[model samples]
Target chain A: MKLAITTSGETVDAALDSRFGRAPKFLIYDVESGAFTLLDNAQNLQAAQGAGVQAAEHVARAGVDAVITGHCGPKAFRVLSAVGIKVYTTDLPTVAAALAAFKAGSLSQAEGADVEGHW
Target chain B: MIIAIASGKGGTGKTTVAVNLALAWGAPVWLLDCDVEEPNAHLFLRADSAQQEIITVPVPQVDMARCDACGECSRFCVYHAIVAPGTKPLVFRELCHSCGGCARVCPRGAITEVARRIGVIETSEVEGVTLVGGHLDVGVAMSPPLIRAVKARIPHDGVALLDAPPGTSCPVITAIRGADAVVLVTEPTPFGLHDLTLAVQMVGALGLPMGVVVNRVGIGDNRVHAFCAAHHIPVLQEIPDDRRIAEAYSQGIPIVEALPEYRALFRQLAESVTALCAARRFVTQGDGHEHRGGGETELRPLNPATGASTTEGANANVRV
Candidate 1:
């Protein structure tokens, strides 16, 4: 299974970005291979509005089964859920830590957006 | 000729000036209330609407049966109103700008336009003055389209006055875009002067001839007067800070109708505006700048020392 994690840096040891939409980068991790790839989210970081929706669309197109992030806005949450992408929240320090929490089934699944749109 | 009454600050008497000017014209004139968000001129005029029409903008509707979510529509939309995550695209109608880029970029022809009503325009007449106003639907964020719809009702001949929204934004631009002249109404306070500067910059950017009407005079300092003089902007009219005017306004009575003596003042305002518009026409024609018509021109901030027409200066100061 593949999962996406919002990160502030390119490496797995990079700190987890609290913001889902304006995160600096995204790490797509493959659970089986234990490998990850980086996806740049700089375009959305500069978006004046609707950054969350655009970022969600970006991750959805990458075929990620789940998303791990500190926060998700209403618009992004709606878009991800509509595409059957499950969203999980975590305050873990780094990408690797977040992935470990997900593996242990300790992350809380978001039933709705964790934050309001435009937050 | 078409004249637009605009103010940078709210509650600066834009509606008061527009209504009184239309009434004072004493001819079959058109008064377009382009402030669709909070149109108040209709309350004062009490015109009987003869025609009404709904204003709408086109939004995209996707056909899911086409069997492919190419993500072209989402990628093409600058506003992010459309998002294609899987086999279907989600459309958020409120954020749509109706640019139709998504529909045009779709290769499968799966996207079609659907009209979404955002506002209504009504035409009415009161005492020989035709009143046309737009009322935006609640929660509708876009108002320029409705303002355009109301402006389209303007006739080719005779005079028309547009009561522009009180701000130097897109909606205000839409209201005053093609006017022959603009009257910026403002008070005498510091806030009034600050906003008046913004309003002057906007009209100057459009290269339209503009003058100032200082409402509620004698209540604040003369900084507004000094600014106008320094910029070579004409101070066409000054309405004193009379409690009676406010009393009359609260009762939905136009000053011209309430006092009757103020009619001559408004007439003088009309004459001054005509003269200013004529002078602008002459200047543009003589300099061969009329052909540019709302196009790129030099922009500079108003330097009180210059004391010349700052139209080009204002145009140059525009950031974009």
Candidate 2:
């Protein structure tokens, strides 16, 4: 299974970016292959609007099974759910910890958005 | 002639000044409350025969059969309002600026323009003015389109007084664009001075003639007037910080109607503004830079909007 984690840095130990849409970079990790790839989100970071929707499109195009981030807004959550991708929110501060929790089946899938849009 | 009443800071008496000035003119004029976010001038004008018109902007709708999922429409939208993922495009109507470029750039004739309601425009005729206000629907992030609809109601030959929204942002520019002259309302405090300077830069950048009306004169220093003096902008009228005026304003009554004495003050203000507009236009025809504000000409001693004379240069060297 492959999942995307919104991160501040390139490494898995980087602190998890609380923002899903405007996150600086989204680090994708594959559980079966133990591979890590970086998705640059600089284009949507300072977008005038629709940052959340565009970010969701990026992850959707990357063919990820799920998205793990600190928070998801209404637009992103809607797009993610529409594409049959589960959204898991974590406040674990580090991507390594979040990834471990996900593999251990401890992180629950979010039913809906945790924060308001433009937060 | 179109006169836009604007202020950079909120609650600096922009609505109060616009309403009273329209009434004090004592003639038929188009009073447009262009602040679509929270239109409150209607509470005071209380015009008769309210008529409402719905405002709409064009947004793109994609036909999947013809779209081919090429992502052309998504790439064409500068606002990122349209995006295609997994062979289907999603339209976020809130992010659309109604530019209509997506439909035009569609390759297979798949995209079509559809009307999207942004706001509603209401018009009513009062004794002194015809009040036109734009009410934006909730969750409508775009305001300039609605503001444009409100201004479109102004007659070509008729006079108009626009109550502009606060801050020097896109909404304010959309409200005040094409006005003959702008009246920037401000107070004497430091915050007022700072925002007034920003408002002046914004108006000045548009190459429009503008004047300052210092509201709540006694509350702070005199740096606003000094800034005006340095820029050659005429100090048009001063509204004192009076408890009676505040009380009347709080009760939804216009100052010109409740006080009755301030009527003369706004009338004089109207005359001064007319002179400024006329003189600036006359000079703009020849040399635009030489006669910006028509500074200090025929002000006729405004009876202070109230009985109190605003303290002049209260902090002449305060370095505001």
Candidate 3:
């Protein structure tokens, strides 16, 4: 399955960004191919409002089966769920660690938004 | 003449001044309570036979049949009110600024504007004034559309008094825009002075002719008066820090009605505002050009049917 992890930088070794909506960048990893690509979320970071919805939509178009981050807000949660994508909350230090945690099934899927809007 | 009573800080008595001044006018006037978030002017006006009308903003509705999910609307929308993630676009109505840009940009004609209720406007008649109160629905994120709707109720050439919401935000700008003059109410406290300075800068930046009504005097220093004097902004009236006024206010009693002794203050305030407005009109007419203001944020014009732009306020402090 393809997974998207919010990240502070472009490299998988970079720290995992806790924020989902305004993350600086996103690392999309394909477990089967062991290959990953970066989706810059700088635009979403500057969004005056609805950062969550727009960011979620950005990743949804990329066909991310799951999203890993520190917390998810209501609008982002709704958009991700409507696309049948499960949200995984993690405080893992790096993108690689979060991806590994997801592979190990150590991360729990969020039932709803872990945080309120604007979080 | 339209006069907007506003204050940057809350509870400085914008409602008190508005209600009393309208009552003291001694003539039929339109009193529009633009403080939709917490409309309190009606409590003092004691208006009767309130007729409420739900105010709705026109938001774009997409037709999937024609929507190729090109995401044109998504690309055009600055608020991210709508987005298409391959299959179809999802709309977050609360985020929509109702700019009508989406429908205007739809190349396939798949998008059409639809009414989405934001708040309600209650119109009622009091002894000396027609009270128009706007109440924003709970969880409603936008108020300018509803505030505009409330302002639209003002008849042509009618004497209207608007009780603007506290603060120097878009709502306050929306409430006071196009008015001949504004009455900025403040107290003698430091907080009041600080916010009053900001309000003055904001109104002055808008090139709005305004006067100050110092409420709850005798508490703070004379800095407020000095500041007003330094800026040449008139101190229209001052209400002393009287506990009885507070008692009457808490009881929903207008000072003019409950304490007839203070009626003269409001009367003089009304006259001052009238004279200020007349002076401004004279200046504008003499100049042969409407003073468009000192690079103020281009407010969402009085286009009720076409919900105007909220993005302009990013430059609100542009001139200030």
Candidate 4:
């Protein structure tokens, strides 16, 4: 099963990133084979302010079963739910711990953040 | 008469027509700038407003003292304005669209609503024109409430020109809801035509009498006129791209003020608008209660053949 993992850095063990466009990278983890590939998100943020949606889209298009992040905005949460991506929130500093929590079905979804209108 | 001036797209000189018309009428006319998000009518009118009022909307204010963080508000909120699943709920003011659904469903009654001031509407008099406009506080998300506040102050007997927001959105809908007529401004560009269709659909849905005012008429294609012809919507006036008009706008003056020769043109536009209002025939709904409160009354059901079979709740007033 593929997983959309939002991270604060290039490595898998870094903190979960919540800020929309500033997150350095996102790791797409393959749980079944324990394989992973990192996709650079710095360039995508330039085109869209809400990188969370783009990150969600990347994993959803890859047929991911879940999303693990520190925080998710209201719009991104809606998009993720529409695509069948189960959202999980965690204090786990690394992507590996997020996958472990997912395997145990112990991951808690983050509180949905508010997003008024787009100015 | 309340006359709303709208443009299908941005930068179509909707404000220009509204300001000029208000000035030319020379009555106690109220100029409502309903484009709250980026209101620019003030830039042209330059009115020194004395009466200013802040506009607010009711939003859910979660009470932390009332006990459990059951997360019901978060789950129920479609926009996710409240998130208090664990501890006290964090209300993100930017994302709250001011829909009162969260407050109504709160079982604990912890979600009492509070008024949040998002913008200010002011009234001023400039050279005999009563100018009313709104300025959205920076970073405010909502605008419809502010538009409503400004419109409520319109003088009933004079020409009320509403400078509506440029779009087919909720704010635009709120601005033009009860207008007697609408003057749609547009240019003759491909983008202009695309957005004009959207505006036309919106106006048709609202069932309002409308006409077009083509600004900068000779600059682009005649596709706008062609579309109007196809739809049987009349083009009431054509404005040329004059450098003199541009100069006047830069100086924050109405065309009627800067160019005395153009006063007659605006007067004619006002006359045409009044004629349109007179030709409308209003059919009141069958609820038996008068809609306009006081007027010569007439009731015409939508489908006379159905008669009593038609479910009529409120009388529909037909005005030509």
- Writing each residue's lDDT as its tens digit, candidate 3 over B87-202 gives 56788888998899888888899999999999899988888689999999999877888899999988898799999999998889999987888899999989999998888766
Off by over 4 Å in 3: A9-15, A30-43, A61-63, A82-84, A91-96, B296-320
Model 4, residue B89: what's the lDDT?
56
Local accuracy of candidate 2 as per-residue lDDT tens digits, B23-42: 99978888999999999999
Q: Which fraction of the native contacts appears in each prediction? A: 0.71, 0.57, 0.57, 0.00
**Model 2 reproduces what portion of true contacts?**
0.57
Per-candidate interface C-alpha RMSD?
1.2, 1.5, 1.4, 9.5
**Over 4 Å off, model 1:** A1-48, A69-71, A89-106, A114-116, B48-50, B285-320
Question: What DockQ class does candidate 4 belong to?
Answer: incorrect
Model 3 chain A poorest ten-residue lDDT run: A76-85
Tens-place lDDT per residue, model 4, A3-101, is: 777776766677666543345677878888888887667764564233444555555556777777766666566556665677777767777777778
Candidate 4: stretches off by over 4 Å: A1-119, B86-88, B281-320
- C-alpha lDDT (0 to 100) for residue B285 of candidate 1: 72
Model 2: how far residue B147 lies from native, Å: 0.3
Residues B114-233, model 4: lDDT tens digits:
988888987778877778889899977667778888888887687788999998777888898788777889988998888877776566555566788888877889899988877767
Instruction: Compare the candidates by lDDT and give the number of the best one.
Output: 1
Give the worst 10-residue stretch by lDDT in candidate 1 chain B: B303-312
lDDT of 2 by residue, A75-95 (tens): 888788878889999999899
How much DockQ does model 2 earn?
Answer: 0.60
